[model samples]
Target: MKIASLLLFFVLGAVALPAAAQSVAEQQDAIVIENLRSAGSDITKPHSIDFFLYFPRKGQAKAAATEILELGYTVVELEKSPERSEWSVHATRTLVPELETMKASTRELEKLATEHGGAYDGWGTSIVK
Candidate 1:
C-alpha cells in the first residue's frame, strides 16, 4: 500500500507541473497582448519617432533605453525625477516606417519581463509615421 501511494503521488506531481507551466505561459501571453494593444492605440505620428524611458535606477533601465535610441530611433527624454533621486525618463522618437521594428523589439522586452515575473518600471515608444 505504501508503494502504491508513492507512485500515485509521483504521478500527481508530474501532472501538476505541466498545468502550472501552462498557466504561467498563458499569463505571459496575455500581458504581451495587452501591452501591444495599448501601445498601438497610444502612438500616432506622420514621421518616425523613438523614445527612452528611465526607471527607479540609473543603471539597467537607462542603458536599455539608450539602446533603443541607438537602434535608429530619434530619442526624446520625457521626465527626469530629480526629487526621488532616481530618474523617471520617457523618451520618444519619430519613425518613418510606422515603428514596426520598434514594436517587435518592445514586445520581446515585454515578454522577457513577464516570464521573469519582475517589475517593469520603465516604458517608452517610437514616434509613429
Candidate 2:
C-alpha cells in the first residue's frame, strides 16, 4: 500500500509538470522583442568602469578577481571587505568606441564568473569625477 501511494504521487507530479512547462512556454512566447539600438553608430562611451562584487568568502572573491585580471582587464583598485568574504574591484577597459560592443564584452565577463560557479553582483561604467 505504501509503495502504491508513492507511485501514485510520482505519477501525479509527472502529469502536473508538463502542464506547468507548457504554461511557461506560452508566457514566454507572449513576450515582445525590442531592439536596443536602431541607429548606425553612437559616439558616446564611458572611458572606464567600476565593478563591485560580493561573494561568500574572500578566497572565492580573490579567485574571481584573479580571473578578471587574467582576461586582460587592468585592475585599477581592489579592496576586500573587513570580514574577508567580499571584494570590490574597480577596473578599466579601453573604450571600444561602440557601446554595443562594450555591453557584449561585459556579458562575456558575466558568463565567465558563472562558469567558475560564482555569482556576479553588478557593475557600472561612466565618466569618473
> Could you estimate the TM-score for every candidate?
0.36, 0.49
Candidate 2, which ten residues in sequence have the lowest lDDT sum?
Answer: 28-37
Every candidate's lDDT = 0.47, 0.54
Over 4-108, each residue of candidate 1 has an lDDT whose tens digit, in order, gives 999999999998885475433344444543565566733333433233233555565556555545655444563456665555545454433233444454554
| RMSD of candidate 2 to true structure, Å | 11.3
Q: What is the lDDT of residue 85 in candidate 2?
A: 59
Give me the candidate number with maximum lDDT. Answer: 2
Which parts of model 1 have CA positions greater than 4 angstroms off? 1-45, 48-52, 82-86, 96-102, 108-129
Q: How does residue 4 of candidate 1 score in lDDT?
A: 98
